[model samples]
Target: MSEAGVSLEMSKGSAPLTPVLSANWGDPRAWKLVNYERRGGYQGLRTALAMSPDEVISLVKDAGLRGRGGAGFPAGLKWSFIPKDNPNPTYLVVNCDESEPGTCKDMPLLMASPHTLVEGAIIASYAVHAKMAFLYVRGEVLHIIRRLQQAVAEAYAAGYLGTDILGSGYDLDIMVHAGAGAYICGEETALLDSLEGRRGQPRLRPPFPAVAGLYASPTVVNNAETISSVPAIVAHGKDWFQAMGTEKSAGFTLYSLSGHVARPGQYEAPLGITLHQLLDISGGMRAGHRLKFFTPGGSSTPMFSAAEIDVPLDYESVAGAGSIPGHQGPAVLRRDHLGGAHRDPLDRVLQARVLRQVHPLPGGHLVAGPDAAQDRGRRGGARRRRQDARRQRPDRRQILLHPGRRRRRMHPRRGEELPGRVRGRLPRRPGMAAAALRAQHGLRPRGLPRRGRGLLR
Candidate 1:
């Protein structure tokens, strides 16, 4: 009736919650460096410079700042994980890939206050004893990328990002790398692989990025929101940070609102803020519409019914309600669309745009007929030849021996390995199947060749 029900605990809190990082989101030119400087944006970098790197790490640890990324790992704890004696250069990678559906906070944050992120990067790099930092952004957001590049240039121009910042002898260089968009890359290991110029895919973790990451060096990979929150934690002491939010989940976060809500935007509040409180700030569901199920954090997080609205939006509490906060926020739906009866207007428009670009194939699969397959093969073969020719340059003889030896080794295994290798190499080729390769190798269909029996010895 009254937007939604506010939690009794939130209503009972006597102290006012402070929203530091997101305090200026509503202001015009909120993203500009001039506006940010006027509001004491880079002040944290100044404070961070004066303190010892260990001291900065201690303050963050004392602040109880957990990761704003999906994992919620302690930010300070993550920094401390890097070995102090290690000679390898430590790195701080800010994950700016806001590809998670309904997660729009980082992009707007960058578009508005790229310096805040840059300043935060400088501070974070200092805390982790990193001399170099990289902000890996989503590739498709070219405008934001340009804005960030400009912001980095400004920081370098001001001597805030380069050597001996504020005469503290702490040097940091920031690089903005645009990712070829992939959802899996948001995962820390996958993000590292993408940063390394490879196709984005999740890597097994154990030797998590804290130990071996980014050129096989100790690295700290944090979400954009997580690193952006560092400046505020440094400016305001750790206790000031710990004072807000719950015990395990300390500090404020930006909650993005979209879909059927009367108002849709970012709301900066403490971690435990409930959906009801958010709805109150966002102007509730659209007019006469009622609440249906909602995703707690984008499509990856599990959905919650209207009855679970009071669950606190912290990592622990929301997880207790059968969802994780992650980087995204809840998508409120007015009715169930399980039967494909309805779709979001944005989704429909996107679908139409995609459909316009490519002809729909039977059963929604892209079809490649003989002609198309032949064209693809020719193009692929031509590209391979060009690459091989480049590698065959006379001046490149130093690396040629390595390639030759690899080819020779692989060739020796071709008889017994041809089936497996052919299947792996030409998985999509129509006529050049693994069975054909096996037959060409003179190997039996299900057993080894007569000569292979003696070779096995």
Candidate 2:
């Protein structure tokens, strides 16, 4: 191979911190192409390049890698749905518009090891016979978009992308798109609408993206984490990926844990990992507080209690426990004593990862919690005026805060952020947990189109 073909200098990367998805996160040069190649990165794409697309798809199906996105569908099965005989060109659209309340994995993956995603995208596009792939990122995350763009440039420069890649006679191009800051766009159909420069909204289904998507052509849409896993699966072979996790849900995955814990961060382990194991490994509840309520995925997922701590965190187990393992992460909160936590000014603590507004009648059985909207008439006119003034901004911090026992030991102080921090939660090494304020959606299939006609991918 010519020196200009690929530049893998003497750069080195650290072994993953006992993490499957984040093995190269700690490496200072992990974002660079040379560093990526040094750690056996793009080799997956090369491996895929050697196999027929069908074989590649079968390998993933055999590995049993479920989607990291909330829906938990089989990744390979989703890919296999794209029609090979279609007359129009097929496309690969990556859902990177990560705006979930308690989720934060893809952004950090892009930041720490962007080339992993770029290589994975190339391989996925090739497997589906797609000549083009598009990554849809949220407009607010400009830095993440830049990082990914740089990775694509590096891949093209290394001859790992574009026409005649690595003398394999394959061609592919990747485009990075930024969407307007809308949480709803995290939905696949809305994301597709936004991608087409139309208003972002959900579409009907039946003709899912795999059949008729983006530009009315067959498309395969997957989130960043799902596609990022493809490289490892393609490189390591089916058994290597399946060796760790259970039979139904094979391979290691990214899990984000937050709230009042001794340590809270991203934990990448096999599918059936239990929260008891996570809490035991980390320092357990913050300041040694006992667990109270926790959301296994996000607010959208039903919350579980302390009694179910030992439940294995897999699709099957979580479902049996009355909650969907929509995503494998959990946001844990400790019981709070309302009186002391908030003083005269009404100090509040946000214990859960995502706290959506819930209003209750004056004396109803399901009254809102401390973090919920409080009684406005409690204070005199002046105090109410001050409260109204503060409410003007009503930023996330103010809204997230809830009256609780005077501060215990919270990792991230209230009002310290604008909702983001999965990177903080990622344990670069084993036996560590990260406390983070916020982090990080789901994709839907087309059963029918609603707004105009069909659903988005």
The candidate that achieves the highest TM-score relative to the unseen native structure: 1
RMSD in order of candidates:
14.2, 15.5
* Candidate 1 global Cα RMSD: 14.2
The best candidate in terms of lDDT: 1
lDDT of 2 by residue, 1-457 (tens): 1212222111112112238569888898789999998999888998998998888888888888788877789989999999978998999999988766567878888888988889889988988999999999888988888888899998889998889999989899999888877665676766777788776654545458898888778988898898999999999888787666666877777888887887778888777777776676665778757777676875445567778887878888887887778667687866652122322222221221121111111111121123322333434456755664565322222112222221122223455443443444453311111111211112221111334344544
lDDT of 2: 0.68
lDDT for each residue of candidate 1 in 1-457, tens digit (9 for 90 to 100)? 3534554355226233445666786688876777888999899888888898899999999898988877788999999999887778999999998776667888888887888899889999998889999999989999899989999998888888788887888888999999876665676777887787765544433456888888778999999988999998899898877777888888888888777888888877777877877887667888877887676676445566788887888889976765667764777777654222322332232231221211111112121111223334534787744654454322221100111111222233444445344434653422224334545665432221222123335
Whole-model lDDT values for every prediction:
0.70, 0.68
Measured with C-alpha atoms, the lDDT of residue 280 in candidate 2 is 65
TM-scores for the candidates: 0.74, 0.72
Clash numbers, per candidate? 1, 25
